[model samples]
Structure formats: C-alpha cells, structure tokens
Target: MEMIFIFIIYFVIGLLASTLGAVAGLGGGIIIKPVLDLFGHFDLPTIGVLSAATVLAMATMSLVKFRKKGHKTDKVVSSILAVGSIFGGILGKVIFNIIAISLNMPTVTGFIQSATLALLLTLIFIYFIKKDKLTSFVFKNRLIILTIGFILGFLSAFLGIGGGPLNVTILILLFSMNAKNAAINSIYIIFFSQLSALILIALTTGFSSYDLSMLVYMIIGGIIGGFIGSSIVIKMSNTQVEKIFNISILVIIFVNIYNIVNLLY
Candidate 1:
C-alpha cells in the first residue's frame, strides 16, 4: 500500500510536469526537481539522473509528434548544436564530480551552488529583457549559436534541466526561427544532450536502483500529458505561448534559489 501510494504521487507529479513541459518547451525536470525536494528526496545527483531520463522520454515523444505534424527542423543547425551540447554535457558532469569531491562541507557547497545559480538567473533575466539586442547580435554572428549551444548543454547537465528553455530561447531569438521550428529544434537539442548526460552519469555514478514500478508509472503519465499539452499548444498563439513559458521559468528560478538558500542556512 505504501509503495502504491508513492507511485501514485510520482505519476501525478509526472503528469503535471510533462504537461507543462510540452506546452512551454520546458522539460519535466524543471518541475519535478522542486517537488521532489519538497518531499525530502532532493539528492541533486539522483535528480540529475531522473531528469535526464525524463527529458529523453519527453523529447522523443515531442519529436515524433512534431514530425507527424509535418514540422521539420534545421538539420545542419541541430547537428552542430547537438555535437557541442554532447561535449559540453560530458564536461559538466566531470566538473560536477570534481566539485563534489573537493567540497567536503555541504554548507559551503550549498552556498557556492546558490550563488552561482543566482548569477545565472540574473543573466537570464537580462537576456530576456534585452532579447531584441541579443537576437540581432546572434543572428549577425552565427557562431554565437554554437557558443550558446555549448553553454546550454553544460548548464543542463549541471542543473539537471531539460535544456529546452535555453535552447528554445536561443533558437527563436538568436536564429530568428519561427516558434514552431524553434520548438522542434529544441527537442532535437534536448534529445542529444540527454543521451550524452545519461551516458556520463551511467559511467560515473553507475545505475541507480530506483523502483521500476514508479518509473513505469511516471513514464506513462508523461506520455499522456505530453500529448495533451502539445495539442493545446497547437491551438495557442506563439506570443501567448512564449509569454507563459518565460513566466514559468522566472518563477522556477526564484523558487529554486529560495530552496537552495534555505538548505544552506
């Protein structure tokens, strides 16, 4: 009964996260991590593993759906970004392991992590506010796309995010791609990044023995929710969809920072 209850909870959370992720181009990890933390299961490394798995599942589903709908992405751009992202993710995993080994104290580690996150959030905010300028600059210099892709991959691995938020923003703003194409490309980027991160984690951390029953439940819920969310997004205007996603990410960043601060002090 207790095991069943836990599965139920995970399934519900997965459904909610996947639904939001599908509509906003954010991954289920962004939502799942905080909720898991609230429930006292907030191991960052473990969450990283779960997040990568969730992203892989969600991205695969989105890719199929987008393809079925006749939405195609830029193969050349996607390939370049994917390659950079894979290397970046591997590097991030290595760096995180080093940090874990070097930092013996959890408090110090927490402080460092929180501060770094705060800085990242500030930069993200600035990017959004001046999106026009950033877009112009990036479009003029296509090389900037590779740089952003690499950075996003590193951050995704380190932060255990789906990388959709970062990838979608860059695609739409930097590449000046339409919303649908940007979203499709984001899925492709996320799929490659997740695959690389998963391999890194498997090699470094080994496989975690999570409850298979719970995993199946979450995956099923995620699939259903993803379908519903994608359908809803098709009906909404691009401007409205973008606004919702940006607001959701802003809220998530602030909440995560607060949680990190609380954990530290």
Candidate 2:
C-alpha cells in the first residue's frame, strides 16, 4: 500500500511537470527536482538520474506529437545540434559525477548550479523583455549553432535539466525561429542530450541496485502528459507560447535563488 501510494504521487508529479515542460519547451526536470526534493527520499545524484529518465520520455513523446501534427522543423539543424549535444552530454556527466558523487560536495555543487542558472535566466528574461530593440541576429554558420548546442547540452546535463528552456531561447535568438517552431525543435534536441547523459551515468555508475520502479511510473505519466501538452501548444499562437516560456523562466529563477540561499546558509 505504501509503495503504491508513492508510485501514484510520482506519476501525478510527472504528469504535471511534463505538461508544463511540453508547453514551455523545458524537459520537466526543472519542475520535477524541486517537488521530489521536498520528499527527502533521494539524494541529488539520484534525483538527477530519475529526472533524466522522465525527461527522455517526455521529449520522445512530445517530439512524436509535434511531428505527427506536421510541425516543420529543420532536419539539418536538428542533426547538427544532436551531434554536438551527444559529446557535450558525456562531458557534463563526468563533471556531475566528479563534483556531486566522487567529491561528495552536493551543497557546493548546488550553489554553483543555482548561481549559474540564475545568471542564465536573468539574461534570457532581459532579452525577452527587450527583444524589439535588439537587432535580429541569425547565424548563417552551422558551426556556430553546433557550438551553441554543445554549450546548452553541457549546462543541461550539469544542472540536471531537460535543456529545453536554454535550447528554445537560443534557437530564437540565434536562428530567429519563432517561438512555436523553437519549442518543437528544442524537444528534439533535448531528446539527444538527456538520453546521452543517462547512458553515460548508467555506464559509469551502474544502476544495478537503484530500483527504478518510480522512474518507470514517471515515464508512463510523462508520455501521456506530453501528448496533451503538445496538443495545447499546437493551438496556441506564437506570442502566447513565448509569454509562457518567459514566465516559466522567471519562476525557475526564483526557485534557483531560493536553492542557492539555502545552500549557502
């Protein structure tokens, strides 16, 4: 009975997180970790593992829905980003293990992650607010986009996020993609990054003993939630989608700030 109850909780949380993630182009990890942390049942590394699994499921389902709806995404761009993210994900996993597991300095790592997140979100928020004045800049070079993908993947893995927010924002700023298309493409890019990070962590740490029953439940919920969320996103206008994305970033910024302060004192 107790086990069943826990599974139910995880499923519900996954549903909510993935729904928001699908709409906002986030990987749901940003939502999931804070909720799970409140349970006090897992450590940071374990939370990272579980969240990555959930994000993979969410991204996969969201991408399928987006493609089914005939949402056009640049296959060439997606391929380039995926290739870059693959390598970046591996590097991020190595760093995460070194700082959070090997060194056993989770608090310090949390401070670092939250601080960086605060900075990233602040800049994104400012850009969204002042985008009109900013001259549109589109990178003609595929190499530059690939490099940006690598950096986004590294940050996503290191911070245990789905890399959606960062991916979407960069796509809009660098490629001048509208919000709707950026959100769809972001999910595709996130699929590669989160999957690579999961594999790397599994290979290095060996998940032989960590019971993933909860993760399985979360994945199930993520699939269902992603479908529904994508449907809603498909109906919304680009402007509305951009607003939601920016609002989510502001919320996440506050969350990161709180985490940073807690870690410091």
Candidate 3:
C-alpha cells in the first residue's frame, strides 16, 4: 500500500513537471530535481537518475506530439546541437558519478547542483528582463552551435535539470529564434542528450539496481503531461508561451535557492 501510494505521488509529480516542462521547454527536470530533493525520500544521485528518466520520456512524447501536429523546427541547427549534446551528456554523467558515488558526498554534490542551477537561472532571468536592450547573435558556424549544445547538455545532465531553460535561452539569444521554434528545437536537443545519459546509467549501474517501478509511474505521468503540454503550446501565441516561461523560471530559481539554503544549514 505504501509503495502504491508512493507511486501515485511520483506520477502526480511527473505529470505536473512534464506539463510545465513541455510548455516552457525546461524539460521537466528543472522542477523534478528540486521537488524530489524537497521530498527527502531519495539520495541526490537517485533523484538525478530518476529525473533523467522522466525527462527522457517527456521529451520523447513532446517530440512525437509536435511532429503529429506538423509543428516546424530548425532541423539543421537542432541536429548539430543534438550531436554535441550527446557527448556532453556522457561527460556530465561521468562527473556526477564521480562526485555522488566515488566521492561518497551526495550532500555536497546536491548543494553544488542546486547552487549551480540557481546561479544559471538567475543569469537567465537577468538576460530576459534586459533582452530588448541587449544584443542577440545569430551564428551560422556549426562549431559554435556544437559548443553551445555541449555546454547546455553538460549543465542539464549535471544539474539534473532538463535542457528546456538553457536550450531555449541559447536558441533565442544565439540564433535569434522565436520562442515557439526555440521550444521545439529544445525538445529535440534534450532528447538525444538525455538518451545518452540514460544509456550511461544502464551501462554503469544497470537499470535493475534502481527502482524501476517508481520510474514506470513517473513515465506514465510524463507521457500524459507531454501530450497535454504539446496540445496547449501549439495553440498558444509566442507571447503567451513567454509569459509562462518567465514565471516558471522565476519560480524554479527560488526553489533552487531554497534548496541551496536547506543543504547548507
């Protein structure tokens, strides 16, 4: 009964997180990582892995829905970025294991992750408020795009956040992509990155060692959330999507701040 109850809770979390993730392009891990931390039911590494799994499912569904709806994406740019993200994901997973498992310091690792996320989100928020005044670049160079994707993948995988926030920001600022196109491409990039990370997890720890049942529940919720979120975003205007994205970013930053404080004292 307790296990069943826990599954239900996880499903709810996944549903909410993925819904928001799909809408805002934050890939749901931005919410999942911090929320799971607050629950205090699992270790930091466990939370990261679980979050990665859920994000993978959410990304997959979001992409499928976007395709079915005939939403257009920057395929060339997204492809280059995704290729870089795959490699970055592997590196991020390796670093995570080194800290959480090898060093046996999950608490310190958690603090680092939250602090990093908070810092990144804060920077992104600042950029957004001053976006109009600031310059936006459009790089045609493939190498630059790859570098950006690598950085985004490393950050998302390392912090256990989805590629949405960072990916969207980069797309908008670096490529001058509109919010809608950026969101769609964000899903594409995160999918490959998260898949690489999951594969690493399978090779290193083996999926069986972890709580597969918990993931099953979360995945179901993520699928539902992905479908609903895709439905909502396709119909909405760019301005509407940005409004939600702005609000969600602020909320996530605060959550990370709170988490950082909790980890410290």
Candidate 4:
C-alpha cells in the first residue's frame, strides 16, 4: 500500500512536469526536482538521473507530435548539434567523475541541487531582460545554430535539463522562428542532446541501480503530461505561457537554493 501510494505521487509529479515541459519547454526539471527533494530518499544525483530519463521520454513524445503536425525541423542543424553535444557530454562526464573523486561524493547527487538552482536563476534573469524580445530573432544561419548547439549541449550534459528552454530561446531569439517552430525544433535538439549525454554517462559513470519502478512511473507520468500540455498550448497565447513558465522557474530556483543552503548548515 505504501509503495503504491508513493508510485501514485511520483506519477502525478511526472505528469505535471512533462506537461509543463511540453507546453512551455521549461517545466520537467523545475517541477520534478522539487518534488523529489520532498521525498527525501532519492537525493540530488538520483533525481538528476530520473529527471534526465523523464526528459528523454518527454522529448520523444514531443517529436512524435511535431512530426504528426508537419513541423519542418532542420535535420542538418540537429546533426551538427548532436556532434558537438556528444563531445561536450563526454567532457561533462569527465568533470563529474573528477568532482566525485575529489569530494568523496556522488557527483550527480552532489551537483544537481546547486546546478539546477543556478540554471533556474540564469533562465529567469534572461527571461525578464528579454521579455519583449522573446520571439524577436529568426535563426536562418546554420553556423549560428551550430554554435548555440555546442553551448546548449555542454550545459545540458552538466545539468541533465534536456535543453528545451535553451533550444527554444535560441530558435526564437537567434533564428527568428515562430513559437511553434521553435518548440518543435527544441524537441529535436533535446532528443539529440539527451541521447548523447546518456551515452556518455553510461560509458563513464556506469549506471547506478536505483529504483527502476520509480523511473517507470515518472516516464508514464511525463508522457501523459506532455500530451495534455501540448493540447493546452494550442489553446493559449505564447506570451502568457512563457510568462507562467518564467515565473515558475524563478520560484523553483529560489526554493532549491534555500534547500541547498539549509543542507549546508
């Protein structure tokens, strides 16, 4: 009964995170990280792995939906990004291993809390400063997209965030793509980034035998949430959705920071 209850909770959280991720491209990590923190059993590294798993599932689902909708994603852009991301992911895994050895801590767990918080804050600051210009630029330049991909790939590997928001922002701000195109392309980028990162982690870190059941629950939740969130996006304005996403990310960042500080003391 207790296990069932916990499963239900995880499922719900997963659904909510994935839904937000699909709709606004910024919800999975922001939502799932906090909820897992509340459980007090998984710690940060476990949560990071779980979050990555969820993001992969969500991205895959989004890709399918985008394909059904006839969105034109630039395959060449995706390929370039994937190559850079794979190399970056290897570098990130090395950094993680070094941190683990030096600090005597599980690298993923030790860094996830602080990393997620930092990312959340950075994203919020960027969103506020460029609120009006959120959808301003269109990135027709393949070289520029490749550059953005390298940066995003590094960050995604380091943070386990799936790179949705980063991809979306670059597509809209730098590429001048519309929201739908940006959202679709972001899914493609995340798919590649996540795949590359997962491969690197598997090769370097060797997988941990955490609770597989929990991962399954999260994946199921993410898939359902993604579907619902995608449907919701069709009914809402881009500005409103983006604002909600930005505010939510800000709140999550502060909360995670507070928790990390508390843990320190």
Candidate 5:
C-alpha cells in the first residue's frame, strides 16, 4: 500500500509536469528533476534518467496528437535541429559521466548539478521576463538556430531537460511560427535529444542505477498528460499559450533556486 501510494504521487507529478511540458513545448524534465530532488526521492542521475523517459513519452504523445489535428511542422528545420542536438546530447552525457567519476563525492556532485540547473533556469526565467529584442536578432540566422539547438541539446543531456521552452521561443521569435507549430517542432527536437542522451547513458553506465518500476509509472502519467495538454493547446490562442509558458518558467526558476539552497545546506 505504501509503494502504491508513492507511485500514485509520482504519477500525479508526472501528469502535471508533462501537461505543462506539452503545452509550453518545454520537456517535463525541468520540473521532474527539481521536484524529485526536493523530495529526496531519488539521486541526481536516477532522477535524470526517469525525467528523460517521462519527457520522451510526453513528446511522443503530443506529436501524435498535434499531427492528428492537421498541424503542419517544418520537417527540414526539425531534422537539422535534431541532428545537431543528437551529437550535443552524446557529448553532454560524456562530460557528465566524466564529472561523476572525477568528483567521487555524492553530495558535492549533487550540489554542482543543482547549482548548474539553478543558473540555467534563472537565465531562462529572465529571458521570459525580459522578452529581449536581441534574442530575435540572434536567432534570425539559420546557423545560429542550429547552433542554439546543439547547445540546448547539450544542456538537455547535462541537465536532463527537454529544452523545449527555449526551442519554442526560438521558433516563434525567429521563424515566425505560431505557437502550435512551434510546440510540434519542439517535441520533435526533444525526442531526438532525449533519445540520444538516454542511449548514451545506458551504453556507458549500463542502467544499474535505474528504478524501472517508478519509471514505468511516470511514463504512463506523462503520456496521458501529454495527450490532454495537446488537446488543450489546439484550442488555445498564442497569447494564452505564451502566458502559460512564462508561468512555467517562473515556477522552474523558484524551484531550482530552492534546490540549490538545500544542496548547499
């Protein structure tokens, strides 16, 4: 009964995280990692692995739903971005593994990871709040878009996020895509990034640290939430979606800061 109840709670967290992820085109990992860390339910790598699975499931579900609605996506752009991201993901995982081996202290490693997450989330939160014009200019170039995708992919692997929020922003502000189309494309990019990262991790670490049962429950919740969120997004205006996106960023920022503080003390 205790195990069942715990699974239920995890499922609910997965559902909420994935719903926001699908709607905002940010992968659920951003929420999952911090929340799990705060609860002390899992270690960093375990949380990362589980979060990657949840995000992948959510992205896959949302992709199917978005397509069924007759939404058009830029296959060429998504493909190029994904290609860059895959390599980035692999490299990021390599770096993480190296760091893990070198550090040797669990607490110190967790602190470093949490601090990194906090810094990135803080930047993302500021980006959402500032709505900088320089962002538009920087993303205008195709090469820059690809480069950013690669960087985000690295961050996704290193931080175990889907990198969807930044992807959505780039698509909308740079490519002039509407919210729905951006969301669809963001999922495609996230799918590739997470898949590559997961594969690399499995190959290098052999999956000895994973909690398979918890992962299964979380993925189930993510799929359901993604479907529901995609359906909601189909009916929403761009403005409404943007508002939700900003709010999600704000939440991530606060949660990450708290996690960093906890890790410190």
Candidate 6:
C-alpha cells in the first residue's frame, strides 16, 4: 500500500510537471528534481536519474505531437544546437560525477544545483517579463549558436534541470525566434540532451538497479502530459503561451528556492 501510494504521488507530480513543462518547453526536469528532492523520498542520484528519464519521455512525445501538427521547425538550428547539447551533456555528467566522487556529500551537490537553478529561474522570470522592450539579436554565426546550445546543455544537464528556461530565452533573445518556434526548438534540443545523459548514465550505473515500476508510472504520466500539453498549445496564441511560460517560471523559482534552503540545512 505504501509503495502504491508513492507511485501514485509520483504519477501526479509527473503529470502536472510535464504538462506545465511541455507548455513552457522546459521538459519538466526543473520541477521534478527539486520537488522530489524536497519530498525526501529519493536520494539525489536516484532523483536525477528518474528526472532525466521522465523529461526525455516528455520531450519525445511533445516533439512528435508538434511534428504531427505541421509545426515547421528550423532543422538547421535544431540539428546544430542538438549536436552541441550532446557533447555538453557528456561534459556535464562527467563534471557532476566528479563532484559527487570528490566531496562524497550528496547534500552539497543538491545545494549547489538548487541554488544555481533558483538564481537562473529568478533571472529568467525577470527577463521574460521585460523582454518586449528589449531588442532581440539574431546571430548568423553557427559557432555562436552552437556555443549557446552547449551552455544550455551544460547547465540543464549538470543541474539535472532538463533544458532549463535558458533554451527558450536564448533562442528568443539571441536567435530572434518567437515564443512558439523557441518552444519547439527547445523540446528538440532537450530530447537529444536528455538522450545523451541517459546513455551515459546507462553506461555507468545501469538502469537495472532502479525501480522499474516507478519508472513506468513516471514515464506514463509524462507521455500523457506531453499529449495534452501539445494539444493545448496548438490552440493557444503566442501571448497565451508566454503567459503560461512566465507563470511556470515564477512557480518553479519559489520551489527551487525552498529546495535550496532545505539542502543548506
């Protein structure tokens, strides 16, 4: 009964987080990691692994749904950014593992991740609110775009926050993309980043040791959320989507701040 209840909770968390995440192109790990961490239900590594798996599922389903809707994505931008994210994913995970091994203190890592995420989310919330007044830049340089993607991947992977708010923010402010295109490209980038992270994790820890039942519930929730979120976004205007995105970022910022405080003590 206890295990069943736990799974049910995770399923609900997955559903809500993925739904909001998909709407905002976050891929849900930003919410999952801190929420689960705050609950104290799983250790740090397990939470990170599960969060990655869940977000990967969400990203895959969301991208498929977008493609079916005839939403045109910039393949060149997506491919180049995704390739950069793959390499960044590897580097991020490598650094994370090193930190874990070096300090032998999981709480320290959690504190660092949560603190960084909180700071980033706060900044995102601020910039997003005032972005309309700012001039958006467009860079034709492939190297610059790839470098941006690498930074996105590194922060998201190392912090286990999926693609984070920076993906859409960078895409919009730097690449001059609108909200809709940025979201789609963000999901595409997250898919490859999470995939690379998962492959690295499999090579290291092996998924066999994790709880398969929990994985199923979380992934199922993510897929359902992906489908629903995609359908909802199709009907929403760019303004509506930006509203949702801003709201989600604000909520996540508070959650992460709480997690950071908890980790510190």
**What TM value does model 5 have?**
0.91
Which 10-residue span in candidate 2 carries the lowest summed lDDT?
33-42
**Candidate 6 lDDT, 1-265, residue by residue in tens:** 9888998999998898889878878788988988888898776777778898888888889988998999867889878888888888788887887786456778788888888888888888889889989999988789987887787788887898888577889889988998877887888888888888989988887876555557789989999988888778878888888998988888888888888777666
Off by over 4 Å in 5: 132-144
Superposed by TM-score, candidate 3 places the C-alpha of residue 214 at a distance from the truth, in angstroms, of: 1.4
Rank order by TM-score, top first?
A: 3, 6, 2, 5, 1, 4
True-structure Cα RMSD, model 4:
3.1
How many Å off is the CA of 94 in candidate 2? 0.4
lDDT of 4 by residue, 192-231 (tens): 6666666666776656645456899998988887777766
lDDT value for candidate 1? 0.70
Tell me each candidate's TM-score: 0.85, 0.93, 0.96, 0.83, 0.91, 0.96
Candidate 2 residues 93-190, lDDT tens each? Answer: 78988998889998788778778878988898898899878876677678987887788878888877777878887888888888888888888888
Candidate 5 displacement at residue 7 in angstroms: 0.7
For candidate 6, give the lDDT: 0.84
Note the Cα lDDT for every prediction shown: 0.70, 0.82, 0.86, 0.67, 0.79, 0.84
Scored by lDDT, the top model is 3
Q: What TM-score number comes out for model 4?
A: 0.83
- Model 6 CA RMSD to the hidden true structure, in angstroms: 1.4
Please tell me which predicted candidate would have the highest TM-score against the true structure. Answer: 3
At residue 226, candidate 4 shows an lDDT of 70
Clashing pairs in 3: 25-164, 26-164
Q: How many steric overlaps are in each model, in order?
A: 0, 0, 2, 7, 0, 0
Superposed Cα deviation of residue 198, candidate 3 (Å): 0.6
Quick one: ranking by lDDT, best first?
Answer: 3, 6, 2, 5, 1, 4
Comparing 1 and 5 by lDDT, which wins? Answer: 5
